[model samples]
Target: MCRWLAYMGEPLRASTIVLDAKHSIVAQSLDSPLGAETVNGDGFGFGWYPSDATPTTEPAVFHSIEPAWNNQNLREITRAVESPLFFTHVRAASGPPIQQTNCHPFRYENWMFMHNGAIASWPELRRDLTVAIDPSLYPQVLGTTDSEVLFHLALTLGLRDDPIKAIGQAIRTVETVGHAHNVQFPWQGTVAVSDGATMWAFRYSTSGRTRSLFHSTDVPTLREMYPTVERLATFSDNAKVVVSEPLNDLPGVFVEVPESTAVTLDGDGYRHQPFLAA
Candidate 1:
């Protein structure tokens, strides 16, 4: 259960959506038509925040247990990198062991995160979410993915003092430790996070069936509906994109993202709400 994308505003080029979009993100790591595993190839990764970053600069990452379409250094380092904000992931090792420190955006200092779904059983809730993290972030949790222990349980329940109320108390502490181990539908998912200048995305599930998320439909409403593509005249009417799907099957070019909501983008644009986390 993995697939990801998050890009925010202008400064582009990570091969314009992880290798030229059209089901891209290395073609959903070799074919993931709306994933839940149709060959996510076990591993891949990316993280960016550079376009002259300085909010405590720590974005450049690139994990790889390889096979994001048989890597050639993930296509020459994502076309030699450029960014306004970014994250790209394609992993399908749901029980965590594809190596490269369990890939995905997962960082901490200036924040970045990624996930597609699953906390459901996670080996019976990974020792109650790794002893509820935050003993100074449990020695920096070097990977045993329930998506990097739900991003250090949303940075020990306060993601820098309120990432949407600390991911709604880190997904209500993963459904209160998966219902005291009885495990009834303990979370499933879609999440994205960023802090080198605001970006957040989420979709939820305790069993309302969530997965698939999308965003992008506001370059003045797709330039008032297409008006001669030309890559929508090279974007930048405050360009934005969020995805677990839809890097173009263009019909209003991506919108979904509405099950328990929470999409936000900054520099004054895009804001969604009602994501009560678990």
Candidate 2:
């Protein structure tokens, strides 16, 4: 398993959440009480869309096989770069070897994606799933992890047209392939995707028990709830964040996403809906 954090609305230095928050994503890389593994030191990644992004513009990504807390560059980059939309992940390798290419927040064109779970018996199902990817998009699958392949699969089905539906389709595809191999719980994880303007996060699995995920309460609401908290001043009313776990212990600051739900974040506040129907 892994831990991930994503933000949309109000540009601010990513370090405010990734490095400086109470239980920052980088800090979680060292001691994550919520992650399946206590430590997620296998690797880390950062992906962000610039403030001045056009529809055709793609986000920039930085990947390293270094532990998030120990990487000097990770510290510097997060401190310097402020993005309206971005994702950061710290990995806890389930089976794949630790390498830069295998890092999360894999990118293709204008979209950025990352996942915090695994495909059961990926080695057995990889072949079937890989071949299902669109030939035009197949060449972009650059990592061995099931995540990158999953992203491409979504793109193949219809992510560009309808992200929420495409992701459900991709997960169903994985389950179908896994059922063929007799993998009981074919897929599992929390996934986040963004195409510069909107961010989508999904919490689902074949078995119904998916990874933990939470989204922050709107900043204005938080400010009213904790008026004395100075940190609350840094954010705008529209700021919304989705994370694998709460960034802090503050009550009402974060809400758990219901199981099998998809959350969409844009100019609209977080909208939650059932993703894969039973």
Candidate 3:
């Protein structure tokens, strides 16, 4: 129901993927080819870690209710800043009101999270999920979106210690609660989270029909494949991006994440593992 991108490489400006690419996030906000919603103009947001940030420093965030393509300030600010790790999102509100507080890439301390999907029958499951959130983290929830709620739920479940395990537990909890409410297929969509260091992206749904998600092909391979593409040469081989959809149409440039899989990206590289395994 929305679109997002997570970049965990090279200290490049956010505009590189948010604006400059062929089918950029901004363009997808206007006319997405792979999204369930064609125009994700409800709002947009981005969170990035400074190149020299310390463990105590929180990542900077910019969220606005303006459409990505029409937000002049978003362009000005993102173009002026550069970070090695960043998360950008263009929202298509499923049920929540359109407001800045409801924007994606929600933050807590050094962590940032964004999502592009919905909690099926959220109205019925909201109370159970909300009550499950650790009381310490409950006071931090500032929006009504299911995405933000899910983020805090993961944190409360131990996101800071083990993101993959915490998230798996969170999803299982959602499924359990949903089943209790007679709601089938409780969760759906792609989610991304970062702690200003490692980045993680998950693609899953209760029915195994999650939204599209992909990671860029290795830069070195792309360079060898398209020697004349000047842009490919600029990226470091370790550069990685996990996006809701391909930023460009180049064949073999992106690989679709398998259903119920979780991708992890760090200084070394990117790798994926089964997300729903018990």
Candidate 4:
């Protein structure tokens, strides 16, 4: 398993959430309270839309095989760079080698994706699924982890045009292949994907009991509840975050994403809908 966080709002220094929260992503990497493993030291990665004039194109990425907590460059970069949309992931290496390429927050064009779960019995079904990927896109598979393969499969199935439907189809495809090989619980985890603006988070599993996932409540409402908490005023009204676990112990600050649901966040607000197999 792994731990990850995604942010979408006004541009702010990455450290404000990635390193400054009470239990920030960096802290969670070393001492995660909700993950299956406390120490996700296998590797870590960060992807963010640059602050340049043309920021909506492709995001800049920084990945390392080193533990996130111990990476000095990550510390320096977080304090230096800022973005309205960003992704950070700490890996625990479910079934892949610990290398830069295997580190997450994978990129394709303008979209960035990270997952905090595993595909059950991946080795058994890898051959069947890999063979199904479109030939032109097949060459992009650069890592051995099931996570990257899953991303490419979603792209092949139409992630760019209709992400929600494409992901549903991809999961259905995985379930169908896994069952034929007698593997129960074909999928498990929390997944987040974002273009430069809108973001989507999904919680699902073949067995129906997925890992923990949460999203922050509206910032304005939180300010009304805790008017004296100065930290609450730092974020803009549109600020929103989705993570594998609550970043702080502040009650009402985070809401658990329901089982088998997809959460979408954009300029309007948050929306939740049932995530069914396609």
**lDDT, each prediction:** 0.85, 0.94, 0.90, 0.90
Off by over 4 Å in 1: 1-9, 12-50, 54-56, 59-83, 86-107, 114-127, 132-136, 139-149, 153-180, 193-208, 217-224, 228-234, 243-253, 257-278
Regions of model 3 farther than 4 Å from truth: none
Model 2: lowest-lDDT 10 consecutive positions:
268-277
Kindly list the per-residue Cα lDDT of model 4 for residues 53-94, writing each as its tens digit.
253589889999999999999999999988888999999999
Cα misplacement distance, residue 179 of candidate 1 (Å)? 6.7
Model 4: number of clashes? 0
Tell me, by TM-score, which candidate is best.
Answer: 2
| RMSD (Å) of each candidate, 1 decimal | 16.6, 0.7, 1.0, 1.4
- Candidate 3 lDDT tens digits, 1-278: 99999887879888877889999999999999999999999999988999898776799999999999999998897898888988899999999999999998999999999998998889888888998999999999999988888999999999999999998889889999999998888989899998888899999999888999999988989998899998886677888888888998889999999998999888777888999953
Clashing pairs in 2: none
Candidate 1 lDDT tens digits, 12-106: 88887799877788888888877878888888888898899997888988988977999889778889887888889888887778899898888
Residue 191 Cα positional deviation in candidate 1, in Å, after optimal superposition: 0.3
Task: In angstroms, give how far residue 156 of model 3 lies from its true place.
Answer: 0.9
Q: Following a full C-alpha superposition, what root-mean-square deviation does model 2 have from the true structure?
A: 0.7
Error of 4 at 240 (Å): 0.4
- Runs in model 2 deviating more than 4 A are none
